[model samples]
Target: MADFFPEEELLAAIDLGSNSFHLAIARLDHGEVRKVASMSEKVQLAAGLDADKVLSLEAQQRGLDCLSRFVGRLGSVTPQRMRIVATNALREATNAQEFIDKAQRILPKSIEIIAGREEARLIYLGVSHTTAAGGRRLVVDIGGGSTEFIIGQDFEPLQTESLQMGCVAYTRQFFLDGQINPMSFERAKAAARKEVTAIAAIYRETGWDTVVGSSGTIKAARQLLMQQGLTDEQGHITYAALEKLREQILKWKHTDDIYFEGLKEDRKAVLPAGLAILMGLFEILGIEKMGYSDGALREGVMYDLLGRFRHEDVRDRSVQALMARYYADPRQAERVALTARTLFEQVADALKLDEEDGDLLRRAAYLHEIGLAISHGSYHRHGAYLLEHSDVPGFSKVDQLRLSFLVGLHRRKLRVETRAQVLHAGGQSLLTLCLLLRLSVLFHHSRYDQVVPTFVLSIIDEKTWQLAVDQHGAEWPMLQADLQQEIVQFANWGIELDIVQLIKAEIEA
Candidate 1:
């Protein structure tokens, strides 16, 4: 038999959740992934956020300290095979960059702060992969700072929504004093109900066959219920059991007094708040029972990474979806993407570009004209706004911003602020990709099926590039004029673009 599991074929994912940090390492055997190791720590990162949405230094340190230990447990998992994802806490923190910069120093991979919808999608991916399929299923994950809800079939998510209500955040909001009174619990439930109301109608309209819960909050609930003999044989939490658990919790005057068999001390503080939110969901959504899953965001990240390695990247699907949604011309997109990729190959070595960079350029090239769907006037600006703001699945916040920078500056005069933004996002490498994309778009300005003249692009130095075109071609004059204009644009961006005729010997060779 062919070797299904190669030596050291391991993948890792780190989930920097608002309340805890999780590290999961898995090995790919055959077509399935089996967990090799896992670890989690309740850092309560969201609990550190002040009223101003600023993450406190103490919380930042707590997160960093946890990551420092996680890094030690990484073992043989290389940086390229690992992904770090941050959820609601980092997304809401005003000074998140300050925390991320410090965390990056401890871990080799940079942290990706995913949008809420994207987080929901990943959560569903993890659940669907781990659990047995049953028509359509509703997956809910109550985290530290946010709760993600997803309805999916098998491995595909149908509807996804994220609410900015979580155990840690709600604890701060309604249970800071540890009081478990009916009024306080009702208040918490009312607040949760209000948040759920926004998407309740649509979710109920598109109902599910089974209800599954993931993440630490729900997992803790199931474990505690099982310990108390409140769960069914299948380990599902029923509405009756949930109510009974609530009654039990309300008997305690404070969080410290709340006690249950098999309940970890660390989970005590957030248990009441988590129960309130879950109960609120059950009442509002009319859910009868919920089955728990060990899978969650970190597992989803590993599965996503595996897809990338297996040539089934979801980001490509997301890009195609965006293009189709914006009514982009596939032919034009193909033309520009092909040309951009060709240019990328020529200077990739000098620019230190890799397959990932090439992928970004290709996607950006295909989407450069998405803004034309809105209006031709400053459509680049419009397109940039759409890309940055759109809840695109399988893309991180930084990925969207970098893509926006390329599309926004593809045709217009490059602004200093735009350049600064691009530099801050991906630095010189991204700028080079932008330059290549611009040249490709310029070459196909006529939007015709006619072939573009052969051109050889070479790097002269860090800030200089030389492009030798076939001067004898029929479209030479028009192309030359376009190049001259592009030269001025490149100069504005502090890059020199030198154009010359293609040498006969070089062309023939």
Candidate 2:
């Protein structure tokens, strides 16, 4: 298997949420993921972001401490079968990579920062699986740094958006010092409303058969409403119930002074901000009621990971969609992809490239020429920009950037500086993959079924490679020129690329 990890094994997902960190472990059973264990900690990572959006040293330490505890509880889950995702806080933090570097030391898996819309899609996925799969539903999840709004039916999300307004962030902005006055509440509500206003028109027009709330904020609100007798036994948060909670919340002079039957000590500080955001959402989106769902982003990640095992990987679908949307030359893309995969197989073991790397190279090959749809000149750059910015679902922010970088490096004059930049981030494996992709793309430059000669790639060491191609292919003047240029390009990147033509004497009789 190209993938080192086995599918259908016990899988885990860790959500580095803005308000809290959550860990969930599950295993596939009868085509469904059955939860084995779960835990959460209120690290409140977003609360630590400074005005410059840098996570404070203190906050970083707190998060590290929490993950350390989680590490102990991880037991024996393989890192390959696990995924850790960070939400809005890390996305906003300028120094997130530094934090991630530190966190990766203590955790079993590398943390991936997901885009907000992707977060929305995952939230909806988790909700759909946990709830009934019928009718159109609007899913709202209020996190510490952002609020995600997703409209979908069944398991497919039609529209997903994330706004930079969340409980912890708003609390810091409007309810700092824990003081809560009607004016402060109004300000928080108004600010949240402004954020929602941008998408309200379309969301309202699209409408929904039901509204679903997921996340700690929504879950807490529902619990509080139920305990306060503001909501029915079913624990649904109605407009009337929301209004009652708002009135009661405004009665408190400060978060510290607030006392309610449903409030937890840890949730008190951020509840007011969360409530205000929900109030704004209710007002602007015309939501009559909302039911809380226990499933959320982490669950969605688990399902997505499971999908990879099930051969229904959404990333593949996303790649195909991009190819179609950009009017990519499917035939040429297939040729490049085939060539790339074949080249990958030749050096994957020596280069330490895994199945994931192979998948990445194939996808990059398929989408490499998408920018041609925009313009042939600098199409690589254009394609990179589109991949970098487009809302390709199922791709993490880092995944998009890596794909962008690969596409950017595919056809350009190999800049030692640019090569160094990629090495600094991705190290040697990425460079090797890029080399393979470049060769594959180069060999298929004719864009036709020119018989590609048999080739053998041998890795001399980490920094040196030798390629032996059939003399028949070497007969092509263009191929010879391309290979000569590639040798220079590889040298620029501090790697030796030696090309040789197979001798007729060495050919099998």
Candidate 3:
């Protein structure tokens, strides 16, 4: 966590957006970001995805080639200093992991694929923080594979929803022939309206005082509308401008012939589709106008990265929220966490782990039995599922996945024997984490008499861990059975667990 971008050190955000990939490098001055450099290429990776949601060879090459160029500008920045976020395209891709594996070979950084709602939240953060603080604002960002709509005030999102309608996907579905007729635009708008309709009721009920549109599509739209002299220099988009734009789009028979001033070359083909989605949003939600916003997800990612260092970690808050939501036993969780930390600290010298390891162990101990709230049987597995699948605001996609995997494999079965096949970089860490979690859980197997007995731990890599217990009450038989059952499970991780019942040198003779 300390490796977070030092205020003096340069920071960067690489957004693997649906339509294009962008790299932004900036310097922090008193917490405000001053953009030093920025680069974006129209990769159209979303369009490159096949029906099976697999990125084609040509598409992968295009993305990698663009990243290679960006890599040159990164200078001496480590992967830890830069945050890379992949959007809906990878989220939908069946072979995303393979693509990521190949990408990491060239980029030397792991990519995070954020969930849709989280994406919406980040977009809102960027918009809110960049813009002046005023009344509640509705922000809409139309991406290549997903469109995010968020209503926020004061840098906090009030309501967020991400839809599967976007420029690239809409272009493919509605304008594949490259002809932009009135009926074609109407149909595209209709499809977009259908997607938006699901959230219309809630959005209307929780209406924003002002509407702001962000992203390449809306920005381009606002620029074009300004060209028509329909809007002022503020770059406001209006419903009447959309009406006139529709008339002009209908006049142009084909997309190749359609040219609007200030429109980027790559945005040409998808412009119509993007406009249609925008039109749909306006009509369905009755948005009279929308102001253009300069910020979006990439900027938000940088702020989030910086926040982790400033001690306002959203991850910790998200974890605590989960425990509270699930009605987890606070007393049990705290006791287990303290006991686990004591043992971890005692063995940290022998184990060669760090404070980060301590934090993870503490969190895992605190929330180990949250799944028990769902059901008594297989609660550990259920808890794992919840952690893995839930949309946690402060955590990166991979971070949540790793935590979930640890929780899942805590007591039931060790999924660490096959390290070669492990998908995450923290496989060893997870195994160590699971060992501590299991010990904590087993220590408090009974609900009453909550004080955890003293214990000592010795680590022997992934395959073997030994525990020395100092006390055995009348419940010794039950605890022995529990610890022995864990030994068999630990073997699955290729580790032998040796439980030493070392009593203080005293016996009732």
Computed on alpha carbons, the lDDT of every model, listed in order, comes to 0.91, 0.87, 0.82
Total clashes in model 3, counting residue pairs 3 or more apart in sequence or in different chains? 3
lDDT (tens digit, per residue) of candidate 3 on 124-167: 88888789887988999999999999998898888988999999
TM-score of each: 0.98, 0.96, 0.92
Which candidate has the top score in lDDT? Answer: 1
RMSD of each: 1.9, 1.9, 3.4
| Candidate 2 local lDDT, 104-212, one digit each (tens) | 8998777889999999998888988889775999999999999999999999999899999999999999998999998999999999889999998999888899888
Per-residue error for 159 in candidate 2, Å, reads 0.4
Q: List the residue pairs that clash in candidate 1.
A: none
What order do candidates take by TM-score, descending?
A: 1, 2, 3
